[model samples]
Target: MILELKEVHGYYDKSHILNGVTLSVGQGTSVCLLGRNGVGKSTTMKTIMGMLNPKEHCKTEGSMKFDGKELAGMKSHSIARLGIAYVPQGRHIFPTLSTEENLKVAARAGVDGSCKWNLETVYTFFPRLEERKDSKGDKLSGGEKQMLAVARGLMQNPKMMLLDEITEGLAPIIVDQLASMVQNLVAEGVTILIAEQNVKFAMKVSSDCYILERGAIVHHQATKELTAETRKKYLGL
Candidate 1:
């Protein structure tokens, strides 16, 4: 497994978010965390990225390992340098910066010091971003901003990507485009763990699915095995 979590628990103030949540993503495969809003899908993503610090009130517990290295107490930047890139839900691009600048700010070689992604190569992979290279982030549409967000993460030359709710609040067409983009990344051998509410899109992109409810995973199965009955049972879809 490229990423593994065993009985991982997370807290926000006094509110328990993730209750012994466990999941794994293998090398070069895509996994989806399927849940409704407030089901701790985003919390799982944040926990894996080490964004949830062990504050006085908020804390994280249990094992989170990536590439055999423990990530329970590591800082967020340290985790990023270890080849795990996070494309958060909000498409958090620098609003004033140009598209090229946004990508450049995240540019870094892989952990092995190999540079598989750079400005030119990333532009080629995301041709729409190439077309808008000179445009400021705030000027782009929703879908364009999402593309830039994913592209910027790729600029890090990461081995694995943690995508949190990337398909929320988008048109169906845009969601389809993003799905295709994610598929291309998996084909290029980038392991992905996506937290998503859009079941159709999630089912289309991921090989395995974990249904999360109230911070606990209620179901784990291959995507091909997810029947409509199962979706309705856990997801109410």
Candidate 2:
């Protein structure tokens, strides 16, 4: 497995969020974490990225292993350096920075010290971003912002990407485009773990799916194995 979370637990202030959540993602494959709102889908991504620090009374426990190394106590930057990129929800782009600058600021070699994801290469992959290279982050459309967020993460040349709700609040056309982009990423051997509410898009991108409910995994199966009955039961689809 490229990533593994074993019996993980977390708290936000005094509220316990993740409850013994356990899951794994194989290298070079795409996986989905599916759930309804407030079911700890985003929390799982944050926990994996080491973003749920002890501050704000946020505490996490249990094992998070990446590429054979423990990530339970590691800092977020340290985890990033270990080749895990997180494209968080909300598409947190730098409002004042130009699109190109946002991508440049995040530019870094992979953990293996390979600079395969430079601006030119990334621009080639995301030509829309190149066209908006000079535009400020705030001026971009919602879909463009989302693309930039994913592109920024790619700047790190990560081995695995933790994508949290990448398709939220977008037009159907934009959603379809993003689905193709994710497919291309997977084709290029980038491991992806996406947390999503759009079951159709999630199933299209991921080979395997993990259903999360009330902060814990309720089911794990191949995407094809996810039936309508299961979706209606856990995801309320």
Candidate 3:
């Protein structure tokens, strides 16, 4: 497994969010955490990224391991340095910078300097970004912003990516495009762990699926095993 969380709990001030969430992402496969709003799906992503300090953003306890290395208490930057990249919930990008500059700022040499996601490589995978290379982040559309976020994360040349809410408040057409991009990334050997609400899109791209409810995992099964009955039972679509 590239990423593993065992009985992990996260808290926000006095309100606990993630209650003993446990899941794993195998190498070269995609895993999806599905749930409605405020179910700790985003919290789970933050916990794994080391963005949540103990009892601060959340009380982070339990094991978050990547490649068998401990990550619970490590600094967020340290975690990023360990071949882990994160695309946050809001698709936050450098609003003042051009698309090219945003990607450039996120460029990292990687731990071994063998990373493969350079500007031309990222551009090849996301042609929209290439066309909008000179546009400032604020000038781009929502879909473009999301693409930039993913591309910037790729620029880090991570071994695994933690993507939160990849398809939120976008046109269905844009969502479809993003889904294809995700599929292509996985086909090219990118390991992805996604927190998403779009069930069909999630199931289509993920190999494994986990259902989160009220900050806890309520159900889990392979993506292929998710039936209409099961999805309705857990997610009430």
The lDDT leader among the candidates is 2
Candidate number that wins on lDDT, 1 or 3: 1
Clashing pairs in 3: 11-58, 11-59, 55-59
Top-TM-score structure, candidate number: 2
Worst 10 residues of 2 by lDDT: 48-57
Better of 2 and 3 by TM-score: 2
Tens-digit lDDT track of model 1 for 25-52: 9999999999989999999998888888
TM-score-based ranking: 2, 1, 3
Provide the lDDT at 138 for model 3. 94
- At residue 139, candidate 3 shows an lDDT of 95
What 10-residue stretch in candidate 3 is worst by lDDT?
50-59
Tens digit per residue, CA lDDT, model 3, 1-237: 888899998888888888999899999999999998889999899888887775454578899899989998899999999998899999998889999999999999766686689999999899889999999999999999999999999999888899899899999999999999999999988899999999989977898999999988999899888999988888888
Residues 192-216 of candidate 2: C-alpha lDDT, one tens digit per residue: 9999999999989999999998999
Arrange candidates by lDDT, highest first: which order?
2, 1, 3
Task: Give per-model CA RMSD.
Answer: 0.9, 0.7, 1.2
